[model samples]
Target: MRALRTGPLLAATVATIGVFLSLTGCSVAGDDRPVVMVSTNILGDVVGELVGDEAEVVTLMKPNADPHSFEISAQEGARLRSADLVVSNGLRLEEGLQQHLDAASAENVPSFVAGDAIEVLDYSEGDAAGNPDSHFWTDPARMIAVVDALEPVLAGLDGADSTVISERTADYRAQLETLDDEMSTAFAAIPDERRALVTNHHVFGYLADRFDFAVVGAVIPGGTTLAAPSASDLSDLVDAVDSSGVRTIFAESSSPDRLVQALASEADISVDVVQLYTESLSDADGGAPDYLTMMRVNAERIATGLST
Candidate 1:
């Protein structure tokens, strides 16, 4: 069973590292908007609010792309090289793109690590790699840090538009406050005993802490999906679910849900697999189109799902 888990993740890691690195360059020829590239779709959404058609914010990773395993193209390198500013979640979330970010910095491209605004969960990716958990946006209060960090960076970009950036950021920050308030109210509806979460990976430590749910366990058994679970790990998780009385194992839409479904069969327990946005945001029409709506949708699902 250990081999069942480890084999695929290892293969995924190798396959990922094998891809041609995304391109980098210094020219945005034939481009009209001020070039800005955001590492994740989640950050891209927030950036869009501050800039609001004033700039073309490049979202490098698409919706549902696993931050750990996303591939990049040479066009992306050109975008990075030409970007006036680069916004990233940082904390090693971009496994393949980290060095590219460093390159941009060395070239004196203005960049900001969005995660710097929040308290981060640090973890070793495995024995060989050291990486932080890098999922701080799960907690909206901590996410204020992302907005705070964006202000100075945006201001630095627009001396003429400092007032504009400040006003936009201030407005967006208030909206975030509202979103956090909504999440708190929604989470407050659930009972204490039923408010336990078992997810694909350790993505929600901050969310669990903020909204009063206990992170009973994770499917990966480690900090990341990059790490595979042993048979023992699966067995331990099964035991945790059974003992904790959590009727659900939340899965992300990005990855295969078969493993969790299979684990449920083996454990002889009935469980509902609830889907949630963990790593990416939906397109404009989906339940979690942007960060605020994503959290709102998740809070509703979590609160209602657990309280049942």
Candidate 2:
């Protein structure tokens, strides 16, 4: 097995890649076909659907990994700097990778921020209020918008077949529309009063906005999972949950549910804590292995948890 390179060696290699390419009059990617590196698996899946076999899609985040804190290997970091195009979920979502993405951009790599393609939402309450919500995939309509935006970006890549990209994007947009409709119909069955959400963190803002649900509270009281809940924070959230009469508190599949379970117990009310595929996609054989499946599974789970 090849040992991983790190420290100054990796940084120097990444830094000199551009100079090496310029000296050799060769592409930095070193691949004949276009290579696109995505900061997260969700965007990777969408990019894969559009590019198909046209480009080599490299995803940094693994399935079920926390996007906010996940980091790529030094070798992957070097590869990222050389990618023909780099895609990331901006708005400070990839907290651990901001520096790497910025480095890629500094080198003039064709970088795309998927969050920029959609209508971003701000947290209306809690510690996360006024901050941009990076979890826009919860709204399939926004994802459709992303697909429309990404189609043009992918088409612009050299060696990418514009016709193939366009056709695949259209098909994927239709699927997103269908998912939006299904989610709407499913969420409609929940009583307005019952459509209150309490989760591990402020992750369901977009879903709540799109489905007419209210984000009652969150155990962590922030947008990113990195935030911890103080005793007062948990107490406040518990009070909010009890006052809202929310019977279920949702936890993220990528995160531990102990805090959510503790919140349920602290609430002094009969509340159930359930897990949802909120932050990341699952591996194959898991319930949510892709964007569409993740949203569908989350919708069904949310509706079931909220209704009863």
Candidate 3:
């Protein structure tokens, strides 16, 4: 089986940093306001929008980092344990940080999982078939559900202003609704035959479900980027690509696109690779810095990629 590998040197470096932070007793900067430690940058952005100035939101994952494999510094782990409220994209999405999340839970930190707030979809194919998908943020309606569930929790935080949270919640929810409408409009123009998705992994199942697009297949054979595709897996995907006539395959910003490019090149039919902000938010200068903007950009790209 061909695997997507992380270098041992990088892993060792991260481990060394983690050990140093733990020994130094270093923690994230804090203030009198309640602290909200979030697992992923995508949820971090949304929580920041909802909480505004009510709480100090600290996101562990950096911009353009992979949630499935990104490790937190021990100092950040300390902050996570001490936070008044913890928010995470659950459904086993934070594969590398599950231990820290569990430790925080054991410490009795109040937590809200966005996955719990939505109608979950299971992986429909590959080794992860029937596993709950953690990529629900692809659908704006599901995100609105998360907001609906999270508002009361944030309002109830000891240091947060319930009135302010309620106001922000309503405003953010309206924005999500608008995003849903705009995405619908954009995707409606795509011809029915062209409304199909082939991504680096099964990151777009929720999107396919929400927008009536068929998921042709993935370059990787599972839901998580950590999984590898065997020779047969890649051959099968190439065959599916040839049969489906899907010209555009999406590469996630959080993952390297070499494998996706390879798949495109190996396909019997000519295919183009398009990058999408699937699992993480990018830096300020990057195109997909926020959740709403990311979704809008992806919608436009998908529509354009498929329409042509």
lDDT of 2 by residue, 91-193 (tens): 8899999888988988898988988999899988767789899999888888888888888889988988899989888888898999999999999999988
Residue by residue across 236-271, what tens digits does model 3's lDDT show? 999999888899999999888898898988885678
For candidate 1, lDDT tens digit of each residue in 40-139? 8889899888877567778898887788778678878766977899888877778768777887888888888877777776643332234566888889
Name the top lDDT candidate.
3
- Candidate 3 lDDT at 138 equals 93
Off by over 4 Å in 2: 1-31
Candidate number with the higher lDDT (1 or 2): 2
Count of clashes, each model: 4, 0, 0
Those runs of model 1 whose alpha carbons end farther than 4 Å from true positions after fitting are 1-33, 123-131, 158-160
Better of 1 and 3 by lDDT: 3
Model 3, which residues run further than 4 Å from truth?
Answer: 1-30
Among all windows of ten consecutive residues in candidate 2, which has the lowest summed lDDT?
Answer: 1-10
lDDT of 3 at 120: 98
